[model samples]
Target: MTYRTSLTALALTLAGLVAHPSPAVALSSVQWKSCPAYSDEVIRSLRVTEEQVPAFRTLMKRLECGTVSVPLNHRDPGGRKIDIAVTRLAATDGSRRLGAIAVLPGGPGNSGYLDPILRSALRNKEMAGLNERYDIIGFDPRGVGYSTKAACPLSPMGPQEPGTMTKETARKIYDSQVATNQKCGRSDPAFLGQLTTANVAKDLDLVRAALGERTLNLLGFSWGTYLGMVYRSEFPEHTGRAFLDSVAPPWTRLDRHTKDAAAAAERNFGRMATWLARRDELYGLGATARQVREEVARLVGAYDKSPKTFAGLQRPIDGSAVADLAKLNSTEWVRAGKALAELRTTTGTTAPPTVKELLGAPMMGTPVPGAPETLNMTMNLAVACNEDAGRTGFDTAWRAHQRLVTRHPATGRGWGLGVRCAGWPLPVQETTLRRGGGSLVLAGHLHEFMSVYDWTLQTRRAVGGTVYTIADDVHVSATRVPECAADVVRYFDTGRIGSGCAGVALPS
Candidate 1:
């Protein structure tokens, strides 16, 4: 799914999150079990269906495909079974195969099944070099994408009617959100317990065994960094090369996350405002950058009364949503700016489509980690409640938010003191995720409000790796920045971690 941008307030608010509990010591020896027994004619069964057989054949022509069944519980050799799905785009130069490279996507929930195809489109010389020698492997992790998945009905967290929830109303809504998460936990007792980094790392091991590889190379992003870290710690012998971009450290606190995101997003929004103003001729929102800021402020203020409606649906165009839209690279900004300006400038008598209606389809296959179409509140609450060890309450969140909003009004009101994930019911996982290894590269840009540099810094510390600070103002570096991209492709291809990589320097 397309990733969601971090709200500026989320960055600031989340910055305070303390390091998670010290993780359990890595497990030695995964009690290996034979693949789940299935009909030997499983392939034959697929082939028996005329249309399905041809589709499988077409898939095989492009890539080698396979399924490896794993124990639902790694601790129990004999337990309920789940199959992990894997696909590979083999090295084109058949004779010069280096080994297997696993693409670890972000979200702690996003799938990596399409990275091989996505990387193929890059056509960079360095990426081409890796393509020539390595079979890029993409797999959907347990509860994500095409893997053994989990679903919660939308009835619990459905969208509100426009003007139904003000900031005060949102707090009340969050009470039910907390209950919904607690209920989801009760609904799916088994899967919820098994979603930790350690379990996922072990899942990687099963995939490694199935692929018949002694060592596996990893490429991880966002939350995927922790997955790789855990994998490395548990099976150092199985580790090969690893490259992490937009790193999420194992020890970030909610408070620290909130602070960093808020500060960074405030700046990113300003940058976005400038970019928007530059094309004022098209968007016509403002004649200059300062004017653009005024225009954006006007939009936010206007939305407070009633969100702008695009089509028939309501739009929760909150601060984070706005910050997310700003983080798009320059190319996307122009089109987004035009749309945003028109939406903001239009009168209430005429409305644009709600964000939900405009983006009717699921957001998939893009750099943003969370699925924009999925219920945001659900995922935010689920993951945060699961990951947050913080013991603070909604009242605490509200008080803190008031302080921030009072200070930075324009961006603050949207994020300032919002009680989205503060009311989670489950106890946070108390594991500090540091994986010691050699030559891991942590990369992130300055202004990724969602996956901020703090995450990168924390991940670098945890993995005993170096940080590659991008000289750009956007987030999701590997896909956006050129120099950072080159360094990543080089590291993956040759396992070279550059030394003394510097942050963006001020001009002389």
Candidate 2:
């Protein structure tokens, strides 16, 4: 998945701040135990197949699962306590082990627990080297994953179809979001107040203490990079070597981030067009980048006029859905082009299975099984709505949306942080711009759709660090690119990372 697609889904799905120094909570002792069995629903949600369940379970058996109690309100440690679920894969070479390395997942709500296991299962050789020397830790932040969860009444409104929502429709959607917020606030004001990035950073320090680590090595991706930065700022003395991949800009507001994302989407879409044109013999979309883009525009217009209903799709396919298909990774461009070609032929034509599956994945709806009912959405909203330095009013959001649409018509409608958080209840938490002068490394793709290259430059300025650039359109480094992966491991092993790991060229 491209960073844009994942972030867009997260924007459509989850929905959070900072505050004054709270009384520090000492990390209580924890007893490690065997990981509990995962339900079929949870396994499927994790994208683990039923056939791999046994192996997954065996891997889980080797790991330890535990919980650490932390204050519900950091300001008052003696107040209500909440459990933070944690998992650890011990170092294989305990004799040569270094300190703990925590893997923070992207979504403010994404489970950190699965990353270590997933990396091990994939036999990520670079990560394997780090695993040999460091205890890989994963933990769900408060109100996420296996930790104490916060619930909210489901919003009746869904994401408005791109380019289709009018003033009245947008207002109704905004109203529904406010209603959902109102309901949640009424139920648990304290819990809602505490779900900020600063709190999560504090919780992480507690986790580090529980693991008996004086200093923490960090591997944070996407939003995790933001969390890692927070940790670096908060506990500079305790931060060890850190790798922040697909970094979020340290000072960019949510609205600016959205705008930057839209601009990046436009650039990435052009790159996709170039890639697709080179493969015209296979996909038959167009002969040049311009032609391919024109063809896409034509198709979008036609589909918007008369939406098509593919077999098994709950709703008819519209221009917004077709445009969104382009928002995927470059690897999926050919498939998306082919899918678009098939859809343009006949309204009744059944979409290719791949296309159907991609399109059928719910963009907005109820939370999936085994996922927290509202934590993901609520936390995202809480952090974004609170930490943002710009206006959070509906008018500002609507205007920004309009500007984004005007500038990048292809994937603009789904770009900005919508008006749902316009009237968020939490007080704005000023973002702290400090960074730990540790051995830090940040990486980004030149054509990254979500965390754009500009963010890397901004982050480098905000936090002194060396940047490893991948000249292609990949989202997070160290995931698919071997060079990037090796650089990450190399940095962790020896506090030095070489620059200029050329990006892999997309296959034509």
Candidate 3:
């Protein structure tokens, strides 16, 4: 599944001042286990069902994907089996075959199995050096697409509608999420319980053996960075080189990440306002960036005071609304500006365009609404729940809200960390995130809205590797910066890290 950094984690690493790589070796603790071997055809057949074979076969040529069956519980070597989906793009140049570079996509829920196809979106140019030498591989972790999925099936119906969630709604959505987790948890509590990073890293090692590789080079983004770090710690011997982009510190708890994301949203508002001011003619918000920011703040406040009618739904255009919008499409600065301008003019003034019209739902001109939540929420919650086990409950969350609102009035509740898992069903499987063995490279943004910088530092210390700081507002640098990409690619090509990077500052 695709994962992203919490806003808190993003903010702390914005300065782009994190650190460089270190010459570290992979961990030797993990012994390579014997994997049941399968032919290419057999491997391809494993990820699909009898009925899906036709489509799977057709798509395989386009994407060249395959699947492998693993025991549901690793400890119980002989047990009910689950499938792990994999896709690979072989080295275009056979003479340069470097091995395999595994990509761990963010979103504990985002499908990485299809990443080879999506590589054009964020694959580093520096990766070209290893293009012919190594195969780029993406996998769908358990409970995600094409893999043995854990069903928390959500209906397409809207929240206020029969199957969707609404402000007043509860059981339908709650049960869906809870029931999904319970079913997956019950399937093989031993393995499901063991779904921690440490074990997942072990799973990677097995995948490496299955593919007949000596070491695995990795490129991880956001939450994927943590997985890379964990794998580095658990099975350093398997490490070849790793590039961790938009890093989230290992020590960061769910509560802290959420809080920091809210704060970053506030900062984003200012940046967005400035962007809007530059194009005032299209959106007559203000003459200056600061002026435009005030107007935007006023618009958000007005929407909060009274829900606005948009896209046939009475939309509560509050902080959550703003955050969701940002997460859905932060890259399109101009389109978002236009939408904000229109929102200001139409809110409370008239029944604005349908939510679809307002959000440019058709996907031609603008992004589809709820895209971020649809792709991000499940995995975000999973990671948060797993990492922050000691904390739970509405009161605990409400108190956090109290602190956030006091500090950030403009974008507090809406931008603040949400407790969607307050009533989560299954207990978390892991808590502490430690770094050991291998030389891992963790990257962070100085002022990211989702993850905090401090968390990156904690993670760096835990992993004993350098953290690269971006010193910018952009979320994950792996996809955004060529320099960062070069740094990552260099690490993967050889076990060398740039000396320019540094460790997180210690607390006074």
Overall lDDT per candidate, in order of appearance:
0.59, 0.73, 0.56
- Cα misplacement distance, residue 455 of candidate 1 (Å): 2.6
> What are the per-residue Cα lDDT tens digits for candidate 3 across 300-325?
55655655544444454554454344
Against the hidden reference, what TM-scores do the models get? 0.74, 0.89, 0.71
Clashes within 3 Å, all models in order: 45, 9, 68
Which scores better on TM-score, 1 or 3? 1
Cα deviation in Å at residue 228, candidate 2?
0.4
User: Residue 418 in candidate 1 has what lDDT?
Assistant: 42
Candidate 1, 67-128: lDDT as tens digits: 66776566654656776767787788789787888888777666566566444323344554
Model 2 stretches with alpha carbons more than 4 Å out: 1-18, 39-45, 49-55, 120-123, 158-163, 347-349, 352-354, 364-375, 503-505
For candidate 2, give the lDDT: 0.73
Please identify which of the two predictions, 2 or 3, would achieve the higher lDDT against the true structure: 2
| Span of ten consecutive residues with least summed lDDT in model 1 | 367-376
**TM-score for candidate 1, residues paired by index:** 0.74
Between candidates 1 and 3, name the one with more favorable lDDT. Answer: 1
Q: Indicate whether candidate 2 or candidate 3 has the larger TM-score.
A: 2
